[model samples]
Target: MANVAAILGDVVEGDRIFSPTSLHLPEFLPAEAVVYPTTEAELAAVMACAHQHRWRVVPTGSGSKLAWGGIGAGVDLIVSTARLNQVIDHAVGDMTLTAQAGAKLADLAPLLAQHNQFLAVDPAYPDRATLGGIVATADTGSLRQRYGGLRDMLIGISFVRYDGQVAKAGGRVVKNVAGYDLMKLLTGSYGTLGVIAQLTFRLYPRQEASKTVVATGTADAVAALAGELRRSPLTPVSFDLLSPALANALGYGEQFAVLARFQSIAAGVDEQVQALSALVGASLTHQILGDDEDENIWAAAGKALFPQPEAAGQTVLAKVGLPSDRAIAWLAQLPSGSLARIHASSGLGTVRWAATTAEDVEKLRFTVADLSRAGVEGTSGYLTLLEAPLSLKQSVDVWGYGGNALSVMKALKAQFDPGNSLSPGRFVGGL
Candidate 1:
């Protein structure tokens, strides 16, 4: 601790690091100290010293999503990038931007808005979500239907390895390289492999006009409408199927609903809306929201999906991936009162439920597995517990491990963090 403090000279105590909502309690994972490094060089030096001492270190960026993954064991130091928040560059003409890992999306959004451009991500806790934190979690929102996830937006990354060595991957422009795809490798690694210092992303110009078309019907009917929208010529920025509870929470009537967003020139958006309405006909109750109404609806929708200052019982946030054709069937299997927010275009969704006892959590876990396997298409599905109580997390693997890539992930972790000093036991298969 003395050696690291001497090198970094910005040491802080680790008290008050954990929030009440934190999945992992600070009392369980006692840290020797917390250090903040402003510059990449200082960060590397601190990491190298920790590596030399063989001390476990956990990296943090804004601490927005710190309660995301399994709590890493034996952590001795908490290296924070809070002071590393800076917008390094914004090549507006090139439609690319670069910023330090700790740079908050809230701060960067306005800066990019000046140029009529923005990064295409709408992670929960956006006001505090850092660039590195979003990449580490690979978090996304409704924008995913149009711009894709973090892996798609990321173009370059600069990170410091466990041994204090700096590594680079990709470049400013989108071009293929000869070696490993570090951009994809570390995007959702949960800071187990390396500590991201800076990142570059492809930016998109903000749309001129946006509107949402929402329609309600039975679960099966909504599912069919989702398929129709996917097959139709109309282009939507986001297509989501909301559960009745979630729909009501988002300002819609308490009924199954299909919500789609269209953004473009006024005429283009209007055309798409009319075509969509005609396709659905009078079979379902439908409405078109103008600019102000659209914004309000989407804001309420965001709250429904990721309620601000989440209520005490809303402890679980799980991401499920499966074919859209099976979404309705799969959703029917969930326990009553579970709120689901699903992406209709992509077969991805999030389910939030409250469980009182550990046994109840275990039961829900099995339900997820059974429903995923029950797919009629004979295709596999995935359920990852993005957030949960520490007790619930201890009983089952948060990330169900069935893929063949576990060995490769182990190899990469061993190679990147030979001393097992970086975020030990917080990744897939406890890599």
Candidate 2:
């Protein structure tokens, strides 16, 4: 501890460094000290010191997702980008924005709104989730149905490597793509590759109007509507399949439901809403929400599935990926108390619940295994445990991936951090 403080003392202020005991961190990560670096250079210096001493480091931003992924063996130092929050540039004309890793999404929203532009990804906890953390976790919400994931919006990235060397990839402009696609590589590396320092993301013009059409009915009826909407020409920003519990929580009755949100010119949005309502017909009860009602519904749905600051250790959260056609069936198979919100087109979303016993974990694991066997041909279905009690995490593999990419991922991890000095054993296959 003394050695770490002495080495990094000159890089950052003494008040910016503290003992790990002062913060609420996961028990699996036994970090000696936590340091907040205000600039990319200061962060690079800290990484260099840790590399020289072969000290394992865990990179974080606000520590919101520190408990995600696998439990690490241990960490000697924790480096945070909390103080590195800053908007580097906002090229309004170019439709791109560059910012520091610690800049919260919530803070960027209003700024972009002022220019009638916004980042297209809808990640969890915008109030506290930073650009780096959102990219690291790949937590893009249902907006992915239209705008794609964070990797798609991200045009460039800068990070401090394990050896304390700063590295960059891509360019600020959306058209620049001359180098290795490290932007995508580092997007979901879980900080096992490097510490994200800054990012540049492509932005979209804010729509003039927005509306959501929510339809509630039996699983078959909702699935029919979802299929019809996908085949239609209507473009929705969000198309999510709500599980029974999630639907009930959203005041939509305890049944399967699908929520489709459209954003465009006022006339366009109104036409699409009416078209969707016509498709709903008499098969299912439906409602069209506009203005504040539309925004509130989406916010409530996001909060229900995403991990919150208050539900840290007491709840279990998992990311589910399956065949889009089988999403309704998959939701139907989930445990009774579980709440889920999955993207209807991409078949990716979150499932969460308050788990109390070992039996509950086993049952969920069995359910996942059964579903995996029934997935589409040549595609692997997976359920990654994102957040849960330490005991449950220890008992089950957090990443239940049984694909053939383990060897390749291991090689990449070895090449990135040879000494295993960055967030060790916290990624897939213990990469």
Candidate 3:
């Protein structure tokens, strides 16, 4: 038998010191590693031991989003994905690819390139983020403008539940909505539900033609142009609004930018470009560019959002979802003294905001109440902290109280992971 103590060296010190997988990840510390298994069988065995000993487990990929949720209340063991890296299958005819949980996205990109296909949802740090981590965090990223998100790409999953069950859901094909949409259910469950072992995602054909439109304006002007383009029939693949502060972070300095991407057949791409150029004419500074340009610009834009924890500050990064029109109103509601930005994906209905404050719990509660009073119902407009104080973990509700869905979630969790051994107290409705 392998000694647990001997298995992990320097990962734990005197049973106290620990390491988070993301460099300078925020609001999380001393997250010790327990075991990293290469296959589902090994992962299942680890889960059994954890269930038996009642050890709390937290699964991680590249650790890109370690601070997005509150620190786990009892993280006794961390299941890192460093060992389980592989692209198990890439079925072009099937328009899907099955990958090991630990496979770095960068590694898979080239393989997909050979088949003239790509994962639609591209997070900022694709080269580093593991496939399983992307599914766990639901890291949609900027490409979501055209392809939607992980919630859309992920059609199947394989995971080790807390009860030692190696579970699988969905399949390699697109038509199976068969039983429960457990695949979608687990996308953003924050690992509180299970440790994902493998993933199968829908793929998109590589675009034959692609271009980016960069419109420059002040915060208000950029928001206006973003609004106009959103209403127009010309469909851009991605839309990004960089707040002045965030623009500074991206080094554009004084030039808050609006980015719209369009790609398709060469003729269709040209038509969209002509229509878009007409919209931003004279009213803004515009740049017409190609795919290489799109990659360079977005790489700069998206990378700016994933800075290290210290750079993110002791502030809270919150994701706000509201109707697209009311989306701009948030710039006024947030603390004037704070650093904040907005990126609206596919109109204003699904928007993400990032901000920093000294006291996130109080600030977040106030924002929730403010949006709720304004009738941000159904959603009640909750914000998950991007980075926060550990003390805030006990005080702030990362995902606030839900209504009926919360009950269903609890039951589902109970059915799958009765012990709450995975990501204790770190997910929505305290799952």
Evaluated with TM-score, which candidate comes out highest? 2
Ranking by lDDT, best first?
2, 1, 3
Q: Is candidate 2 or candidate 3 better by lDDT?
A: 2
Question: What value of lDDT does candidate 1 attain over all alpha carbons?
Answer: 0.78
Candidate 1: stretches off by over 4 Å:
1-28, 176-179, 308-310, 357-359, 362-371, 374-378
> Which has the better TM-score: candidate 2, or candidate 3?
2
lDDT of 1 by residue, 50-115 (tens): 777788888887665666677667677777787789888888888998889989998999999999
Estimate candidate 3's RMSD in Å.
Answer: 4.3
State the lDDT at 397 in candidate 2: 78
Candidate 2: where is the Cα deviation over 4 Å? 1-3, 21-23, 356-359, 365-369, 372-375
Backbone N/Cα/C clashes per model: 0, 0, 4
Candidate 3: residue 24 lDDT (0-100): 43
Give the residue spans of candidate 3 off by over 4 A. 1-3, 6-32, 218-220, 251-256, 310-315, 332-341, 345-379, 400-404
As for candidate 1, its clashing pairs are none
lDDT of 2 by residue, 161-279 (tens): 99999999988899996789999998889999999999999999999999999999999999889999989998999999999999998898899999999999999999999999989
